[model samples]
Target: MADVSANPRADREENPLERQRELMELLSQETRHSIVQALLGHPKLLASSAELNHFVPSKSKKTVEEQLEVLVDAGIFALYEYPPNEDRRGLPWKFYGLTEYGADVLGDFNYLEGVPMARAVHRKTRKPEQIERHEAAPRPPLPESVRATFRLDEETD
Candidate 1:
């Protein structure tokens, strides 16, 4: 295996923003980003999918699972398999935490400010369709009664 400490020539050639964008694309959803942020806050700590569900209450199990797979594939998270003796009769429960690269990217954001990892990630992962959906489908206008109830122009005399 090649020395892991040294950056590959290819990686060196890529611009920093591009790399951050790739990382962000891997962590696109709110749930996935929350998971990574939580792990960054607590390094090397393993969190089960159930635990993750608790952390991101809005996301469904299937959604979280998909995000976790993406993170694992992107090398942002390390998945650990539980020993057979620990739990039997079901699929092995996997715990995930941030990898060294994940940590570095997060750390560089908090400490260095040398690169905008979060923005880059958002830019890379955000799709034009997604933007259009959000923009085109504005929320329904508030009920007239509800709107009248909180009129900013009317002042208590």
Candidate 2:
């Protein structure tokens, strides 16, 4: 019989760039990146569609669903049903968490294995005082004419 156990590191040592490229492609999209980050931070926390929707509020439901599908297809997440409970229809809601492969990828220490730019820069630069002061010093609201042109529900089909 052929050897069933092979050292995984052999492949990475053989083609590190290719593996890095694959990882980067998987996390290229902002929504996809956010989903991965969320799962990474809370591995055991099952995130539902609604929870994901709230986590990435700027994205539409359709977009969030698409991201979840992509992650599942990439083998980064697994889907499972929530247990039946009161005040709920118990309809199967997709929950996502990192797979073994995902954990391995995340654990990889190579800098090339992730987005080229670090997300920490944005967080470090945005001080709470800046946000609070900006919030308190809000400028005039949008003009009525511009407000009339804006429709929150308007979306491209």
Candidate 3:
């Protein structure tokens, strides 16, 4: 009943790009995709929920939270929490980083890092006030993995 010329694959039982199509569909959502991009561009490859939220300040925090949950469920992200011993008298500090698979997938978009401010690495292109706010934001100690990756070790006395 369908026109074969107009819909050649309509009757096909299998699609060669099914997996990639599914992944694309999942990442098609702007916010979801942006979250991944932000992480991939980060110098330490990690950020807190609060810090990440700043990148999309217009969106409701709950939206970011839910998207993060979805990414974690999809195995694209790993949540890192600050140990209680170093707790800062508030809610547990939550940081996020990509899984190995996530990094591999992100490699497919290496060209995206050429945007303004060079993939959001330096905030110099941002409004001066915005930069001020970001600088003033609380920077909880980065996880040890990030420290080692960025080589921020303390000198032994």
Candidate 4:
């Protein structure tokens, strides 16, 4: 075994490079890479979850959503949801956009459309409790408080 006195941090402590490695591993997967690539070339740099599904037709809706959730959790994507329809009959539009950090990672690493490096896929195993919670959890509600208000002369939407 190597000497331990030189290192101060514990074995479990995460450093910046490790986090980036985690992200690279996440993005290296085929389905996840497709999702990122689609957004990279998009005009708005954003896409609805359903739209991302088109990029990876081989995967099911649930799989795409799961991958989107992972990206969202990793802070690589910011989710914007549209209001529910009248009577709240169906799911709201959950649009995922590339966050600034996401854009930087893509640009810096040349992961554009992927495939320069050999794929090292990563899939985290889930515990039973985690699986149950993830399946049962409701979509997170939008914030109710307004921090700032600004007027815009032009409305794109």
Evaluate residue 116 in candidate 1 and report its C-alpha lDDT on the 0 to 100 scale: 39
How does each model score on TM-score?
0.53, 0.53, 0.61, 0.55
Instruction: Give stretches of model 1 more than 4 Å off.
Output: 1-12, 41-44, 88-93, 111-157
lDDT of each: 0.49, 0.49, 0.55, 0.51
Q: After superposition, how far is residue 30 of candidate 1 from its true place, in Å?
A: 1.4
Please report, as a residue range, the 10-residue window in candidate 4 with the lowest summed lDDT. Answer: 144-153
Candidate 2 global lDDT? 0.49
What lDDT would candidate 3 get against the real structure?
0.55
lDDT tens digits by residue: candidate 1, 14-55: 586777676556555677777665433221244556555555
Off by over 4 Å in 4: 1-14, 84-92, 112-157
Residue-wise C-alpha lDDT for candidate 4, range 80-127, written one tens digit per residue: 654442234333345576555555566667754442222121012222
The sequence of per-residue lDDT tens digits that candidate 2 reaches over residues 20-52 is 787777776799977765443321334555555
When 2 and 3 are scored with lDDT, the better candidate is 3
Model 3 lDDT per residue over 20-129, tens place: 56657667678887777666555455666765677666678899989988777665567755555246544335567665445444444442344334345534325345
Count residue pairs with overlapping backbones in model 3: 0
lDDT of 1: 0.49
Candidate order by TM-score, highest to lowest?
3, 4, 1, 2
TM-score, candidate 1, is 0.53
User: Candidate 4 overall Cα lDDT vs. reference?
Assistant: 0.51
